[model samples]
Target: DLQQQALDSLVQHLADHHNAEALGVLCDVADAAAVERAMALTVERFGGIDVLVNNAGITHRSSFADTELAVFQRIMAVNYFGALHCTKAALPSLIARSGQIIVLSSLSGFAPLLYRSAYNSSKHALHGLFETLRYELKGSGVNVMLVCPGFTATDLRKNALVGDGSVAAQPPLAMGKVASPQDVAEAIYHGALKRRRLLVLSNVDWRARVLARFFPRLFERVLLPRLSGLKPQRAGRF
Candidate 1:
């Protein structure tokens, strides 16, 4: 809630002062049909999509045992399938233009957090998909970058799904620990500009990721406690 208001205010200020003709906001869901329509509209308007930012996502805060099937699927639908749909729709234009694809993932993608099964799985799957796609699309002049942001304030928490495929009782606020929306946007721009394979936005996220790899048991022992405490109350109930 704090971050949303700030972000909205910033957008308004920029939109007013900059008179940014290149910037246009649209309401397009990440579903297959919506992406298809968006792509068609974009191509019709701008001639083609030079860059694709696959950032649409939702979150969940519950253990796998407590998470419902529908909740899990909904998370996948928005976080993973949404990206897929948009990427598929935009690929033809990107391929033609030799453009770039930027994916906004999360730290949870690299290292799992307790009580975040749906959210973690969606991001992990996204990482796998994009990493493989990058290799497969080599020499095609298409660049893919995955941007992993660590806990910048976002409304997804307020709207995050719970076990019953409904909004969580509380926002995902407590789970996130660092950064800001502007910080994340800057990271996104920098990574896209440099065409980096993976751009980690958080100050210590990369280090944490590496540490987790080198010391799994130790990482879990430390992280699980912190994560468990952040779990949403009454979240797992179907």
Candidate 2:
């Protein structure tokens, strides 16, 4: 976590409530060296990793034409390369333990959303990368699970960056009924327990995927207006 206090609170909560021995390592996933050190510490503390969850990500809200190139690079660095780094660092331990890799992706990974080109591309890249890894790792006893959750109530929107790399002035519109983080977590837990390859968390996202896949024009006609309405009111050019 970026904030050590949040990490410590979570660690303490896990210990107090779940009786789970947890270690909090303050490291930025975007930094390869930091991720390596974090992985080393985890392996040192726990002997080996059974599950590696690539959940670190950031989102941006801006039209592709107006977004600064640096914005896209920053998003990709954290959302895609961050996951890549952690996976690489933990692969040996995971392989040794026949462990699982859980990636917290989004419905946007497969389905398109307005003003999030960078975020969408990063998640798409994740699906491509990990799916291939899964195929290559077949019979290797390492499971890679990709989870696609719909609009969940989380700080992601509050922390979303704009084209100028500042915190967004407005929250991005939700396409469907907002999901609770608890519900999403429950689904992820069950999905991981079953070693499922793909876990789509919400019916809204499932329907959107189907619509986007089978009826692209209709999907656009229906979704575009809603998304367009949510576009930030500020000037597009940064």
Candidate 3:
């Protein structure tokens, strides 16, 4: 988490409710050095790493024309580079233990979404990077799982960045049934246990993935209407 207080709260909750031993290390995933330090501390505390979950992410809600270049950079820093940093720092420990790397990508990773160019591109990059890494680590026993979850009920939407980097005034419209974080977590846990390569949570996201891959034209026609309400008022420069 970005906030130490929230991290502490979560740690306490896990300890109290789940009787789980969890160390809350406050480190921003975008910062490579911080990630390294956090990973080192975890390895030191736990003796070795068994699983590394790259779930850090952020989103932006702005048309490409309205969005400043810095906004794209910021979003990429948190969503893409953040995962890259954690993966790099934890790779050696993961490899040593023949561990698993679970990446939390989104349906937008493959399918496009309106006014979310930065977010979509970052998730797409994760697929390209991690999927390739999976093949490279085939004999290493380090499983790489990519999780694509559809619209989940989270504060991510409320905290979405706008064109100028401010929080988005309005969250994007929900196209299908929104999933709960708990349901997504359960799916991820099962996927990891089975060492599944790709886990697309939710029926809606699964349909989107199929449509986007097999019928691009039809996907555009179907998805465009659901996302049309999200189009920015300002005319796109392109």
Candidate 4:
């Protein structure tokens, strides 16, 4: 749980819905010590961590020039360093068990979007770090999966930061199908079970990945106007 209320909500949700025992621990993944404590609690509750899911993330939705430096820093702290700290804390158990590591990346991990410089950067960092880790753990039996979900219907949208670091009051422009959070979760679950290296959910996400890979210049030209909620200027007759 990243926040106190998040822990309470998880506990209550588990109590109300699931019969299996669930453990909750408060952690600020940005803090190495906090992650250690949370992982320790997890180990104390269970025998060992078989799977490490680095899913906690935050987003900033302001243009690079307008967005505050602090906003970018905060996003990196939660989205990149957060996962780094958690993975570091859980590595020993994961190595011993040949456990799986599931990283919650985004379509932006490969596809760039305007007004999301910080968000995209964090995810790109995850890909670089985990892809290297995957090679290192190839024969060690620990499989890594990076799940890239397209725009999902979730609270992260409500928490997106604007230029001044304030939450954006309006909802984001709909550039693609907004997948249900449940759908994304189920896809991630199955992908982890199958030991997939990179799972891009939804057709929209796949298109984004493909465009970025094979038609990057075209993708960038189209994405800028779309994300900015504007139409690109047409070439005027000279």
Candidate 5:
């Protein structure tokens, strides 16, 4: 629903600007056939795809101790496999057009917090996949970008699954406050236009990455202690 709304708003804006050349919005679940069909439709209509954004993702609030095997797989299916399916489907057209592929990662990918085993692992996997892909496709005229956002105000947490596979009412965030989704979107757009290698969505996230890099021991000893506490646990567990 959020992705559709975003795409609708984008297409409406394009139509308002009288850009008839802009491709109409196409949305599909991150399934193999769906992704393939969507990619085919985009190529058939637009003649080529210039930018492919793998933004379909989901979050779950569950620790490994109580997290069900199915729940973990569900999160991976949506967040990790979903992006992989879309990228693979879009690759042919992207390569043909010498276009760009942008993967929306998260601060968790850089620094894992508590109770986000699935989400953190998914983004970490994405970071690894795309970073390597970037190197492989370096001279092929295809650009790969990773955009990591700290915390954005969205209904993602509300949709997060708890340990027992129940919905988590409140989504814990890295920062107490979240930046607007529009702000992150704007940054993503700018980075794509400029062909930037990586785009960090917020200052806090940037600091976390820097701290993880320059002061690994201090970050693990100091920062991890606080962030790790945010993981959701049953009341009786502690």
Candidate 6:
């Protein structure tokens, strides 16, 4: 079923998305060797890498106290190190083409999300790493862009791991309006084309920025739970 889903997504992309030449490979991004192989295959298929979008990520929903070290490590490997591997593997081609690296981070990267310490930490690391890379490669022509999209319509929560590292069976509680995948894609497309440094999609992401900037303590105590599905009573524990 997993393989079928992957193949279906590929088939659908081939059917309705890019031209007949777009390719998809089912490689684990967390594996550095697999990432390198994927890059090699991409070069063989596409001739060169022009734009690299590191969108693969995983999430875990549990209190920090309940989260195990393995859970934290697994999340970091996917969300942070996965990007690192792909970027490193594709750097040569990217630099040669003056390409762009697009990172699909979350609002949690900048603003903490309750019960998602590992996820938050991973995204924050991505921001720091890529932002620094932007300056380091300033004259190299390779541009880096980090996208922070708020909660969107996706099966992310369904695939998220629980406290015991099992797949979350039920969807999380809905917070507010959710953005469609198509909408988020369009924003990313335009932002990448323009070589923008940061793409903050949706008002929810903007609200995270506003809260983090304007009201630090109040944001932590007040709005974080609202965004994170954390009940008000257990604020101090996490």
State every prediction's TM-score relative to the real structure.
0.84, 0.93, 0.93, 0.92, 0.84, 0.91
lDDT (C-alpha, whole model) for all candidates: 0.78, 0.88, 0.87, 0.85, 0.78, 0.85
In candidate 4 the C-alpha lDDT for residue 149 amounts to 82
* Residue pairs clashing, model 1: 157-172
Q: Tell me the tens digit of each residue's lDDT in model 1 across 70-175.
A: 8888788888998998899999999999999999888777887777888889999999999999998999899999988877776767787777777877775554
Model 6 per-residue lDDT tens digits across residues 1-238: 1264776788688878666756667788889998999899999988999999998888988889999889999999999999999999999999999999999998887888888888889999999999998999999999999998777888777688877788888767656678898899999999988999999886777877887878777677767778877654333422
lDDT of each residue in 1-238, candidate 3, tens digit only: 7799998999999999999999999999889999999999999999989999998888888899999999899889988999999999999999999999999998888888878999999999999999899999999989999998777899888788999999878876677788999999998999999999999876767877887898766667665446545332332322
What is candidate 5's CA lDDT for residue 73?
81
Per-prediction tally of clashes: 1, 0, 0, 0, 0, 0
Task: List where candidate 5 sits over 4 angstroms from the true fold.
Answer: 1-28, 173-176, 225-238
Lowest lDDT 10-mer window, candidate 6? 229-238
Query: Of the pair 2 and 3, which is ahead by lDDT?
Result: 2
| Candidate 6: residue 200 lDDT (0-100) | 89
Specify the poorest-scoring 10-residue window by lDDT in model 4. 229-238
Off by over 4 Å in 6: 1-5, 15-18, 230-238
Model 2 ranges off by over 4 Å: 227-238
How many Å off is the CA of 101 in candidate 6? Answer: 0.3
| Model 3: per-residue Cα lDDT at residue 238 | 23
Strongest candidate by lDDT: 2
Per-residue alpha-carbon lDDT of model 5 for 54-76, expressed as tens digits? 88777877778888888878778
Give the winner by TM-score: 4 or 5.
4
Model 1 accuracy (lDDT, Cα)? 0.78
Better of 3 and 6 by lDDT: 3
